[model samples]
Target: MTASLSYAHGTSATPLLGETIGDNLRRTVEAHGDREALVVRSQGYRATWRELWQATTDVARGLIASGVKRGDRVGVWSPNRHEWVVLQYAAARAGAILVNINPAYRTTELDYALRKCGVGVLFLARGFRQANYVAMLAEVRPNLPDLRLALTFEDDWAALLDAGRGVDEAVLAERERSLQFDDPVNIQYTSGTTGFPKGATLSHHNILNNGYFTGEALGYGPDDRVCIPVPFYHCFGMVLGNLACTTHGATMVIPGEAFDPIAVLETVQAERCTSLYGVPTMFIAELDHPRFAEFDVSSLRTGIMAGSPCPVEIMRRVISQMHMREVTIVYGMTETSPGSTQSARTDSIERRVSTVGRVEPHVEVKVVDPATGAVVPRGTSGELCTRGYSVMLGYWDDEAATKAAIDAAGWMHTGDLATMDAESYVNIVGRIKDTIIRGGENISPREVEEFLHTHPAVSEAQVIGVPSEKYGEEVMAWIRVRAGATVTPEELTSFCAGKIATYKIPRHWKLVDEFPMTVTGKVQKYRMRELSTAELGLGKAAQIKMA
Candidate 1:
């Protein structure tokens, strides 16, 4: 009757794990003591389970010696590096809340995060790309009186480690004993479309179990070496990449301080990596690299392509050329420790390419009508919501925002519009806010963007609704053309002629060098919309709609 609005719960005999991040790390180290735990190619760093444990404990002791007590907020602002990994585990071991600061953040955003979370200690690289951390810290340090210490990855960080040697081992051990599974241990700021970012406070149990299950889905083990090019600041890296590896005793390989296509390819070939992780764009860069064929990626058996929907062609190429037959698509936000649904290694290629697979083990997912909050029927588009242990405790220190996000019934309302099949595989349509209403017809930008990606000359496409006079809103696309290839708007729209619905096709097109992206590689559509509207003189269109 009524097709019974979509809802699915993961069924499994494997019960949820009940241990803190520190405890789980110790367990995994004992199980795979001789196995490689970390490898940072840029820094030429390598560590086995024993060595990594000792190094992590040293950092933990250093933090304690520096006056970091349990539950203190410690901010880490750096690109992917060996020190970042050490601090991640060290903070958890020392019973401190690790606040991930985006390496892309400037002084203003950095100051807001530090003050919002009351961060007492900050760990940052001396310099990343062109942004000088020292300068930014100098700008904000005056306002951040709570910040007692600032350690750069340069010489200052060396002194921090040395400070640990003087502290008695019992202090570190006592801090470890005080940690609980449910105590908040991590704070990741959700990159909001408007206003300041809200910190998603997560506990050890939230991320640890999510990571273990994600790794299990990818068939990870002690022998699997995972090459991670994603930033450690995002849940995609810290939880999905690092936590997944540590829980399963797999090796975490860092290609560079930041994602480098050549570095990723070279690392995969040199290390004979078994697993890899990236967003779709990262994969595209690696696949399109001039020297792509030179690398030996045959060792790759599985990996993850997420952060956004994977285009069909890209997914096919990754499977055929990259040898990632078991590449999975994960879907979730930082609020849920990153993954609520994932494609499995056993999933068919069709299933892997089309859906985000079934609900993750021990999680419940449902699609509901946005207007009424009632569950929507199968194959019907609606807001996707999740409920499980993986959900964060709440946005840190923001009760009003937390209440608005999580309902009284405990569902974390993911603003994504989605549909479910009879088999329970979920298909993300687009964000609810990304919907475009043109002449009273609703259009999903994701649907049109996917269609445009099929064009041979289009390297990447991002669609957003810009203002219009004839219609309430019109579809506009910013496209990145293939290198040395050219395309005109007329020719491209003509290519879409019969394949897609007329209204869904983008009306205005702009060829661009690159799309504005977050540190985690998510395209900022709102910024694109703003820029397009101004350049196209659509100010009148905005007033027309609002009025």
Candidate 2:
């Protein structure tokens, strides 16, 4: 472990799971059948591990009876509902690739995701927030030739389970036995810088092992009660939240469909949750809540805080006030089953807040020179690359992207600049890519810029991330209008109102004739970010030091 070369690998004797997700669930149910497995406090629902398996079996058989063949894609577009968890396992049990759609997606985004994966059966909520999912689905259903049926949670939930009553138990057993651990089971749509999202296809081996190791790092057990408020659509929730709990036979507790600080506090106090999960912003909201002190969260021992930098002050408060003495920070992209490096429960406050901890078990991480693609010396900032079992199979149907990201030698070059310390602790400095992560949501600047170009008056558009106190970063758009065409900020806002997610909408708009360019005539996004920060009087926010 000298500081000469930047490379490390986790070696463990514990064997990785070699069975399908359904088999893993069966093993856990056999051991912890009567134990409380899931609790949706918001919906007033609770179920044991055995009950959950029965429900999951019903849905799996129903999917099979509905002409859902193995290897087909089943999409679920909703928030943190109890059924979302069931669908996670049911799809795996039925041999369908479960595609996780962002709940905040509007018509344009949803249409693209549903068509991209050729989702056969879509399960969705009727309405959430401002978007009427039913109406949006109707608008796009005609275009989706592969979409066979769309079922609503409230209307078709019972019917779906009942449809499985006639399915023979031997049918499901045969399907389960025919599956392998290497089969693709989940498709998570992650925003790319190329104006569209890419579906990262993951196998049972990739996600199941990552979840087990992450939970093992935190020492999760059957007695642990985890309160997860993160959305079920992302790896943070689907892999780390639910899979982590199920792998260890822990209880999965949902606070609300969407993030509500009060709901989280109340759920923790009422459920006596032992662990919690969220990004740093979420922890900040809970810690700063007016009635935060009134809740009894003494049951908490450990949890995960990730997706953004963990500030020193915020981490300290979370450890002290939230009773999470062992709160850890994880680092990885959606391509790595969502976790590659994680801090241990015994890490010091300095290491926990400053670094993303050491590499996880059965994975390898290294710092490499981006230009040369050669491993760099430790303590030197370079692009972080990971290679191991947790890497995704590839981007769905995009061979070029798959090759571009994961190299010929099997290394996923994470386009993130980082440095590995002498102790193998990693610290992320900046990203080489153009994706903007605001409030734990990855927003592609190209996607938003393309949407803005749809406006008739918009001649050209550029998007960048600016500093913010709350969300760590906020989206700002610079528009160059077409000649003889009139456009106002109000008009632009009105045009993008229901087309994109609220977070993707620009928080700051500037009408400009030309952008800052390099001598080679390329747009200098770094210069734009600097100028916007100065003009918007956000310099103070930008200077808020990080760990």
CA lDDT, every prediction?
A: 0.92, 0.87
Superposed model 2: Cα runs more than 4 Å off: 1-3, 433-547
C-alpha RMSD in Å of predicted model 1 compared with the true structure: 1.7
Off by over 4 Å in 1: 1-3, 540-547
| Residues 1-547, model 2: lDDT tens digits | 4557889898889888888889999999999999999999989999999999998999999988887888999999887799999999999998899999888778888999999889999999997888799999999889899999999998999998888887887898888888989999999987653477899999999999988889998899999999999888888888998999999999999998987899999999999999999876578668767798899999999999987666566788899989899889999988999898999899999999778999998999999888888889989878899999999999999999899999998999998878898889998866665557787776767568757867878766778888888898899999877667889888898899999999999988999987775211235676788799999988843432222
The whole-model C-alpha lDDT of candidate 1 against the native structure comes to 0.92
Identify the candidate with maximal lDDT. Answer: 1
TM-score of each: 0.98, 0.82
